[model samples]
Target: MLILGTGDVRQVLDGAETEVVAAVRRAYLLHDQGRTALPHSVFLRFPDDPRNRIIGLPGYLGEDEPVAGIKWIASFPGNTAAGLERASAAVILNSMATGRPEALLEGSVISSRRTAASAALAAAVLASSVPETGVSLIGCGVIGFEILAYLRAVLPDLATVTVFDLDRSRAEAFAARCEARWPGLKTEVAASAEDALAAHRLVTLATTAATPHLSTDACRPGTLVLHVSLRDLTPESILAAVNVVDDADHVCRESTSLHLAEQHSGNRDFIAASIGSVLGAEEPYRRAEDRVTVFSPFGLGTLDLALADLVRRRAEPLGLGTRVPDFLPGPASGADG
Candidate 1:
């Protein structure tokens, strides 16, 4: 199989946020049209450490160039203490005709950037009504930084950003870098979630926290929350908001925001609409004066494929990634009798 490392992936997407946003938009559109197939991810827990869980996300991105792939990603919060990213992933792309492995690639950038780009797209679309605003980023990690960059591309009026993280050093470092990268915007570190929430109507939860960090009590009326981290908000918080998910079926099964709502309410009816439905124009946006709006996305394989496709296209011209001979042979010569 052709194995493309992390260096290759990064080279392709180094400064292509705008293209990434467009690709994510297309993925959402395809999802709304029922053109993609994504099964509920399978989580395998370690026998020794129940907390260390590895997940398999397998799916096909339909609607042209139907690339099939699966990503195996592991999440170990303890990895941070060992000087490694909490989440590490690898993707395997297969040939449709031959059913053979074609490409093995690093999935970290694919995971991180597509996620940030998807959130940025949602923020841009939702911000139509609330254009003049600031963004309160709850966690300033790798994903958080990329989200800010893509948000700048989409929402130019995003003139201010209030950041908060449990780690003061990380927050300060993020703020300083953002100030330099985004010279026009004001970036500051807030002391608490409450302080951050109070400063901006657009809130992004990008922390690695295993439990809920923000509450409905902190969210302002008419605010739009991007729940990037699965378990960053409580059920009460989700129930209070006009919930919109990337994929209703997928999010309900995986995202903690949806899980809590489903657990407490004993139903999924509380969900307002899937963001895909909105993208397809099946569910129209209604402006409610006092309703909180939230978009929770369980990272979709189609999105990963879309971004990967984009990266491959860019890398070809830039000579960024290694080119290898065909890993998979053609279709079977004849069918069995």
Candidate 2:
């Protein structure tokens, strides 16, 4: 087994956003082709603390170089208040040939990068083509920063973006980071999430709330929402939009706002199509500009695996990660046999 730390993973992914974005898009296409196994993510919650939970996503990406893996991620909203990251994750990949663990990777960086890439890819198609259209970012955290980093690569013409966070300090810090990362990129601090939502033609919801807080009243018609944080919008808000997701089956589960909307309506007629379908089509689908368009991604494990595979392939040439000669020992009976 090889152990890839956060720094190692970061080094591998740095300056590789375009490549990673393409890899993530391929993963989506493979999934759309029914060549991947993406079981519903398993959620483990606590009765006393409903705001925090750990999720396990097991997936198989089958093709010429098939690989299987599971990503275990934990989300603790209080971590930010304690001066720590809110989300941390690790991903393990197993070889198809041997069915053995090939790598154990620190996954928070991979998770956020893949997630941001997924959103940015959606933004490439869904965001306003007109330059300088307002973009709002809610929940100024690491995820927000990652999204901004990728947006800088994909949508450099986005002139101004408003930011909102429950903590004034975080919002200010995020705004400063945005300015440093993208010069001449205008940013404003919103008095509230509603103000942020209404201030932009493109809105990104990355808040920490486990339950719905946004409503249709906050959104304007023709707005494109990158709902990176699931469960931040009410079911009514979800149903009111022309929804697009990475995976409908994956997103429409785990009590996400979309799930609640499906439960409320007893059908998924509200969802327009998977982003993959939209991307894979020869011609773009026509969406009414008067209706809100939302792209809510479930953060596919196949993406994590793909990115991790990239890191592994890149790092191996440099011999970056720590290698364990034999992470899994054979049975004593093998000696007698």
Candidate 3:
């Protein structure tokens, strides 16, 4: 088994935002066409630590280089207090020919890249055709930085950015990073969540809040919300707009905002369509120009698998990772029978 570290993975990516977006797009299209196999994500909770969980996502993305893999990722919200990253992950890829695990790549980097790509892709598709002055970011953490990086790559017209965080210092620091990327950008710190929500035409919510806080009234008509943090908005807020998701079955679970919306309404009538359907469509899905558009992705394993494959292929020729040839014990046992 070949093990690729975070440095190796980042080297493979090399700040290529368009490539990452394209890879994420392929994953979505394949899934939409029923060409991928995605089992529901499995979450393991600690009895004593309710806020901590390790999730396992196994999937297969069919293509010329069809690959199967599982991403084991852990989320510890408390880690922030200790000044550590909130999440970490590892993706293990298995070969189809030999049914043997081929590579174990450091997954947090790939995970964040794919997530940012997904959010950016949604932003590009759902963003208003009208000219936007700036964008707002609710949380100013690593994920926030990732989203900003991708947005800078995709949205060249961005001239201003507003950021909000519970910690004023963190928000200010995040603003500095944003300015570094877009030296011409006007970066500001929002006084409140509402202020941040109303900061611009395009908004991204990446906060670590555990439950619903954003209300329907917070959004402006024609606003494009990249609901990256699944649980940020209230059920009524979700119903108040035309909602899009990466996958209906996936998003309407784990008591996410969409899940809450479904529960309150007892149906998924508020869901407009999957992001896959909206991408490249001639006609707009949001029937009303005044309707607020929201895209909530459940972070599919299909995406992780696709990106992992990309990293693995790129890392191979460079001889960047550590290889353990005999990770498994033996060969097939059926011959004895």
Candidate 4:
């Protein structure tokens, strides 16, 4: 198997945000076209420490490439305190022609960028306002930074950003980065998540909370909640909003928002739409006057696979990534004989 390390992946993904965003958009379009199979992600929770959780997501992209594969990204939130990232992932691409593993890629950067791009794309479609209105970001970590960068790219009206993080230092540092990279755009630290939500009509939740933190009552009317993390909002909050998710099957299965809504309503019918429908133009992104709009994306495997495919294609010309010869050898030529 070709081993594309994290450094290689980062090199391949550097300065490729626009392309990554486009690739993720295409993945959502594939979903809208009903040309993809996105199964619910399977989670293996630690028996002792629930905070240590691993998820397995696998999917097949459409027939647009010379190859195909399933992506598996494992997330462990406790890794942060150890000075490590909250999650570490690797993506494996298999050749349909021979049914063999073609690439085993480092998935950290790919996962984060694709996730941010998905949210940015959804915000472009669903938000009623423009970048002039600005956006409030809750949880200014890795995902938060990426989202802010992409938001700037997709929404020219995004002239300001208000941020809130449990760690005040992190928020301040993020603000400094924004000042250096996105000058003239206002970046301030909010005292609380509520303060952040109230400051801007557009909000994004990138918290690592395994449970709910924000609620509908804390938000402003007509606000758009970009929920990139699975379980950042309460069920009451979810049911209160015009809910949009990446995949109905996947989000409803693993999202904390869905879990809370299910616990309260005893059903999964509260979801109004998946972001894919809006992206695919199959359904319009309608805003209800009486409710807020919530976009929850569980980070689809197809998105990762799609982006990985793009990275592999680019890295080839740039002489990036390490190659592993005979990763699958001759393949399973005569299996079950």
- lDDT by residue (1-337, candidate 1, tens digit) is 6677899898778788888888998888887787888888898886778567888888887866787888888888778668788788988887888777777778888989999998988887665365746899998888898898888888878889999988889799999999998787898899988898778778898987666667857767888888888788888888888888887777776548788789889999888877776766744465344877888988888788777667665666666655567655556689864
Compare candidates 1 and 2 on lDDT and give the better one: 2
lDDT per residue as tens, model 2, 289-316: 7878889999989999999898999999
- The alpha-carbon deviation from the true structure for residue 145 of candidate 3, after best TM-score superposition, in angstroms, is 0.8
Q: Write the per-residue lDDT of candidate 3 for residues 220-261, one digit (tens) a residue.
A: 778888899899998888998888899999999987999988
For residue 289, model 3's alpha carbon misses the true position, in angstroms, by 2.7
Q: Estimate each model's TM-score.
A: 0.91, 0.95, 0.95, 0.92
lDDT of model 3, residue 209: 73
Q: Tell me the whole-model lDDT of each prediction, alpha carbons only.
A: 0.81, 0.87, 0.87, 0.81
Better of 2 and 4 by lDDT: 2
Please tell me which predicted candidate would have the highest lDDT against the true structure: 2
Ten contiguous residues with the weakest lDDT in model 2: 125-134
Model 2, runs deviating above 4 Å = 127-132, 285-287, 330-337
Candidate 1: segments with Cα more than 4 A from true spot:
48-51, 282-287, 323-337
Clash pairs detected, candidate 1: none
lDDT winner between candidates 1 and 3: 3
